[model samples]
Structures are given as structure tokens and as C-alpha cells.
Target: MMHLIRLELKKGGFTSYLWGSLLAYAIIACFIMVLYFTGNNLGAEGFQNYEDALNAINTFVLATFIIYASVLLSKLIINEFKDKTIHLLFAYPINRKKLILAKLSIVFFWTFVNVVLANLLIDVLFITINQIFGYVSGTLTITLLVHHAIYVLLQAFGAAGMSLLSLVLGLRKKSAAFTVATSIFIVMIVCSSNGNFNLASIIAVPLSLAVLGILITYLSFRNIDRVDVD
Candidate 1:
């Protein structure tokens, strides 16, 4: 399984995705800082303080990468189905279920790992910058940082899993555009916020959605060999 995953990653040429993720991080970092320094002109309803900024940043990253996962899924699966290249893959001397699982595992774990790592680096970077500038009127302590770390990890897991939910909509039409659009719609509902009331902050929403995603992933490959390439 690990070998197959490695082969897929090698052929997927995902180095560019990593570069794109970095660019996203830069944009998010700049966004929060602008909020801090801009003095309430740009609508900081949910981002009232420095601490709330963490949640806002995590939400942005989560939304960004869930959609990221969708685009990759489009390329790795939906596009192949559309172009009839999946028939070639099905011709290989491999278990169809394993091939599908390998592709999915890459997207899931990649989204998971990137979200966690990006939040960690950005959180620390934000703290360091906050120390230098003292923009928001709050003091950071070790206890709060520990708690935030746990929250971020849980959020990352949920985002990673819930990302697969896009497959439910994407595979139905074998349309890449539909896949990506569905992801955006999912992000809007889960991450939407008004005056600090975020759907994801409810805990049950993302947790339940994550569970649903796991079910969707299972259903996706449960009858793999029975699925027709034509």
C-alpha cells in the first residue's frame, strides 16, 4: 500500500501543490495582519481579538485545503473517468479497490498533514509577530497555546475527512467543475461565520460531517470491481 501510494505521488507531480499551499499560507498571514492593523474598517466581526484571529486563520486554512483536496480529486479520479483513462488503469494487474484507495489515501493524508503543519507554523509566526508589534490587546500564555494546539489538530482531522465528502457529489457526474464547485459549497456551509458564530465552532457539525465523509469514502470503493470504466 505504501509502495503504491509512493508511486502515485511520484507520478502525480504534486510539488506544485506544495508550492501553491505555501502561497496560500502567505495570503492568509497577510490577511490576518491586515485585519489587526487596519482598525475595523474591513469588517472584523468574527476576528475581534488576537486570540480569535487563530480561529479565523484556521478556518481560512481549513476552507482553503478542503477545496484543495477537491481539485486534486478532480484530477486524480474525475478527469480520468471523463477521459476514459481509468479504463487503462483498470487494465493494470492490480486490485481495483486498492488503486482507488491509494489515490484517496494520498489526498486525505496530504490535506491532513498540510493543514496541521500550516496551522502550527502560522500560529507560531503570528505569535512572534504579535510580540514584536503588540497589535491586539491580549496576552498569550502557555496554557492557551496548548489548548489551541489541540483544537487545531482536531480541526485538521475534521477538515481532512470532510474533504472527501466532495467525492459524493463529484463522482456522480464525473465533472471536474462540479467537483470543485461542490467543495466550495461545502466550505461555505461548514466554515461560514457571522459575528463569531461559526458553524464549525459547534463541534458537532464538522464531527458529523467528518463521519459522513468516511462513509462516503467507504461507499466509493466498496464495489470497486463492479464499477464500469466504460
Candidate 2:
């Protein structure tokens, strides 16, 4: 499995995507630090508000990670068909299940990396801003840090599921572009809705969609094994 992932990385060039996401996280971290420093006048939260700031931080991080995951996953898996490389892989002893697992593992690994990078970036930015602006008197506690960490993990899990689902859909449809466009459209509709959309509209909708994606992926892989490469 590890060897399979290594090959996928070499052929798919996913490291470049990982680097690109790191660059994006850096840019966003800097922007957020500047905004926080500029806006945090009048000594409002006073070291206690980091917890309060967490929810806002989560929104930004989730949005940024989703865009990266969706696009990268689509290109990685979908392009296998569009580029006609699925046939190349089948020429080896590997089966479709192993190949799909490799792709899924890559997605999961990147998701973990994103969570770490994002949280570290946010914490570093917070400290830098505090030091530069002379707001370092308040003590940083582990409890506050743990809260942020949990939220980041939750968001990453959501993204992992979504990315896998997106890749499966794109591969099955044989159109990375279409899957990406439809995903953006669906996200936009969800975003445009007011908060009145109900509880089910929020959690149930996305959770259901993600669940559907997993099912589709299973079905796609099951069918792929039955496909005639000739």
C-alpha cells in the first residue's frame, strides 16, 4: 500500500498541490493576523477572546481547505480516465481496489497535513500579532488550544470525506470539470441560503451528501473491476 501511494504521488504530482496549499495557508495566515491586529483595538477580549475568535477562524480555514481539496482530488482521480492512464495501471498486477485505496490514502494524508498546517499557522499568527502589538500579558492555556485543535480535526474529517466523494464522482463521470462545477454550484446554493434553512438543512444536507458520495465511490470501484480494459 505504501509503495502504491509512492507511485501515485510520482505519477500524479500531488506534492506540488500540497506545496500550493501550504503557500495558500501562509498567505491567509498573514492576512488574518493583519486583520486581527488592526481590528482588535480598545482591549476588548483580553486573552480570553481567543476562544471566541475560534469560531470565526474555523469558518475561514474550512472554506480555504475545501477549495484546495475539491480541486486537487478532482484532478488526481478524474484525470486518470481523461488522460487514459487507468489502462496503464491495469497493465500491472494491481487491481482497481488497491488503486482506489491509494488515492484515498493520499487524500487522507493531505487532509491531516492541512489540519496541522492551518492550526499551526493560526497559532503562530496569533502570537506574532500579540507580540508586535504588546498584547502578550495574558497567559495562553492548553484548554483554549485544545478547543481549536478539536475544531480543526472536525473540519478536516469533513473535508476528507468530501474530497474522496468528489474524486469518485469525477472519475465515474469521466469529467473532472463537470464534477468541480457542480460542487461549486451546490456550495453556492448552500451559502446563499439564510440561516432559516433549519437544522436538517445544515448538518443533514452536507452529511447526507457526503454519505451519498461514499456510496457512489463504492459502486464505482465495484463496477470498475468488472470493466473490460480492451
Candidate 3:
């Protein structure tokens, strides 16, 4: 599996995607600053405590990367199927399930790691900026920091698993547009918030989505060896 993933990374030229992720991080940070500050202007949606800020940032980061995961799926899997390149891979003596799993693993781990890292960097940047401007209320204690770490871990794992579900529709349609669009819809279901009604805040929501995603991946792998790449 590791060898297959390394080959995918080398042949796939994932360096460009890494650069794109960096750019996404910078853009997310800028938006966080702008929104939080502007929100403080009217004292409306601005964060009232450290937990509130972390929660908002974590959700935003996960949502953005979940959409980004679809792009990876589009490039790695759907595009190959669409262009008939996947036939060459399936022709090899490799197990089709493992090959596809390698690709999906790339998407899963990429989204997971980036969400955790983005939160760390963005959290520090926002807190520093807030310290200078004194817009947000409350301070970050050891208790809150510990809780944030735990929260980020669960959210990262959940986000990683749920991202696989995006491939379900994309695989059926075999369209990159459909893949990305499905991810956007998933983000809406899990991440979007209205006033105090946040679906993501409910523990069961993300967990159920994650479990469903895993089931989807497992089911797809079952027939992958016999399934032709038509």
C-alpha cells in the first residue's frame, strides 16, 4: 500500500497540490481575520470566547478541505476513468481494490492532516491578531487548549471519513463537476450554521456521516477487482 501510494505521489506530481493547499490556508486565514473583525464591528457574530473562535475556525477549515478532497478525487480517480487512463492501471498485475484504496487513502490523509495543521496555524494567527486589536473576549487557558486539541482530533477524523462519501456520486457520474458539487453539498449538510442551529454541533451527525462514508468505501472495494473500468 505504501509503495502504491508513493508511486501515485511520484507519478501524480502531487507537489502542485501541496502548493495549492498552502495557498488555500493563506486565503482561509485572511477570510477568518476579515470576518471576525467585521463581525466585531456590530458585535453580532464575533466570537465571545476561545471555544467559540476555535469552533468556528475548525468548521471553516474542515469545510474548505472537504471540498478540496473532491478535487483530489476528481484528479486521481474520476479523470482517469473519464480519459480511459485507468484501463492501463487495471491492466497491471496489481489488485484493483488496493490501487483505488491507495488513491482514496491519499485523499483521506491529506484532508485529515491539513485540517489539523490549518487549525493550529490559524488559531495562533487569530489569537495574536486579537491580542493586538482586543476585539474578541476571553483568554485561552490550558483547559480550553486541551479541549481544542481533542475537538480537532475528532473533527479531523470525521472530516476525513466523510470526504470519501463525495466519491460515491462522482464515481457514478464519472464527472469532475459532479464530484466537487457533491462535496459542496456534503459540506452544507455538516458544516453550515444558522444563528445557533448548527448541524455540526450535534455529535451524531458527523459520526453517522463518517460511518456511512466508510461503508461506501468498503462496498466499492468489494467488486473493484472484477469491475471493468468502463
Candidate 4:
């Protein structure tokens, strides 16, 4: 399994994706900082404060990750099938289910890690800037920092799960367009619900997404053999 995952990593150009993730994080962080500084002028009430700014950043970042993950899954999974490379994969002396699982695992792990790291980096930068420049409101106490860390990690998990769910939908239809479109729709819904920035949403949304991802993954695994790789 480890060998297969490594092979996929090489074949899938994981390094490029890593670099892309870093670039995306930089862009998001910059955008958040801009909004933080000019939020009042932009008519964004409550965005000048640390908590609200963090919430807004989290919501946008998670949504971006959802789309990003969906694109990765499409390239790694759906494109393999569409291009008939999956036929080559199945020719190996490995269990078909395990092969698919390995691919999905790569998608999930990288997506989760990318989102978590990005969120953490943004949090650190935001707090540091606030401490130095005092642009944003609210104090970043130890407890609040810890809570933000936990919440962001949870949101990362949720984003990864939702991406996988979108993958399952796209794979079922063997349509990259469908997968990307569904991902966009899902992000829209998630962003709408996330605008409130409530404690309950932080818990409820991620948990619900995780559960849905588990179900979809199980279903995808069970039906792997039925998928027409040719």
C-alpha cells in the first residue's frame, strides 16, 4: 500500500500540487490581511476584529480548499479513468480495491494537511501582525488561540471529507465537469452556512461532513470493481 501510494505520488506530480498549495495559501493570507485592514471601508462590519476576521478567513479558505481538493481528486482519480490509465493500474498484481483506496487516501491526506497548515500559518501571521501593528481588534489569549487551532483543524477535516464526497459523485458519473460543478455547489452551501460564525456551526458542520464522507467512501470502495476503467 505504501509503495502504491508512493508510485501515485510520483506519477501524479505531487510536488507541483504542494507548490500550488503554498501559492494558494499565500494568496489567501494576503487577501485576508487586505480585508482586515480595509474592511470598514468595504462595508464589512465586524471584520476589523480578530474573531470576525478569523471567521471570515476560515470560511473563505475552507471553501477554496473544497474546490482545490475536488480538482486534485479529479486529476488523480477521474482523469485516470477518463484517459484509460486506470486500465494500466488494474493490470498490476494488486487488489483493485486497495489500489483505489490508496489513491483516495493520498487525496484525503494531502488535502487535510494542506488546509490545516494553511490555516495555522494564516492564524500565526494574523496574530503577529495584530500584535505588532494593532490593526485588528480583540486580544489573542492562549485559550482563544488554542480554540482557533482546534476549530481550524476540524474545518480542514471537514473540507477534505467534502472533497472526497464530491469525488465520489464525479467518479460515479465519470465526469470531471460534474465533479467540479458539484464541488462548487457544495462550497456555496457551506459558505452560506458558515457566514454566521457560531460555535455550534464549527462543531456541527465538520462532523456532518465527516460522516457523509465516510459513507461515500465506503460506497465508492464497494463499487470500485463496477466502475468502467476503460
Per-model CA lDDT versus the true structure: 0.84, 0.64, 0.88, 0.79
Once fitted onto the true fold, the runs of candidate 3 whose alpha carbons sit more than 4 angstroms away are 42-44
What's the distance in Å from true for residue 216, model 3? 0.9
135: Cα error in model 4, Å: 2.6
Q: Report the C-alpha lDDT of model 1 over 1-230, residue by residue, as the tens digit.
A: 88889988898898998898899888888877777666445554424566687887888889889999999999888898889898998999989889888999999898999889888888888778778777656777788788888888888888888988888788889899999999999999989888777888776787789889989889877988986765
Please give the RMSD of candidate 1 to the true structure: 1.8
Candidate 3, 4-84: lDDT as tens digits: 999999988999999998998999999888888888886667777778887888888989999999999899999998899
Cα lDDT of model 4 by residue, 35-152, tens digit:
7667645666546466776777787788788888888889888888778888888887788988888888888888789878887888788778778767676766788778888888
- What's the CA error at residue 156 for candidate 4, in Å? 1.5
Residue pairs in clash, model 4: none
Q: What TM-score would you give candidate 1 relative to the actual structure?
A: 0.94
lDDT of 2 by residue, 65-85 (tens): 655666767766677778887
* Regions of model 4 farther than 4 Å from truth: 40-48, 193-200, 223-230
What overall lDDT, based on C-alpha atoms, would model 1 receive against the true structure?
Answer: 0.84
Q: Which regions of candidate 2 deviate over 4 angstroms?
A: 41-48, 131-140, 186-212
lDDT at position 180, candidate 4: 91
**Estimated TM-score for each candidate:** 0.94, 0.77, 0.95, 0.90
Sliding window of 10 residues with minimal summed lDDT for model 1: 39-48
- Cand. 3 Cα-lDDT: 0.88
How would the candidate models be sorted by TM-score, starting from the highest?
3, 1, 4, 2
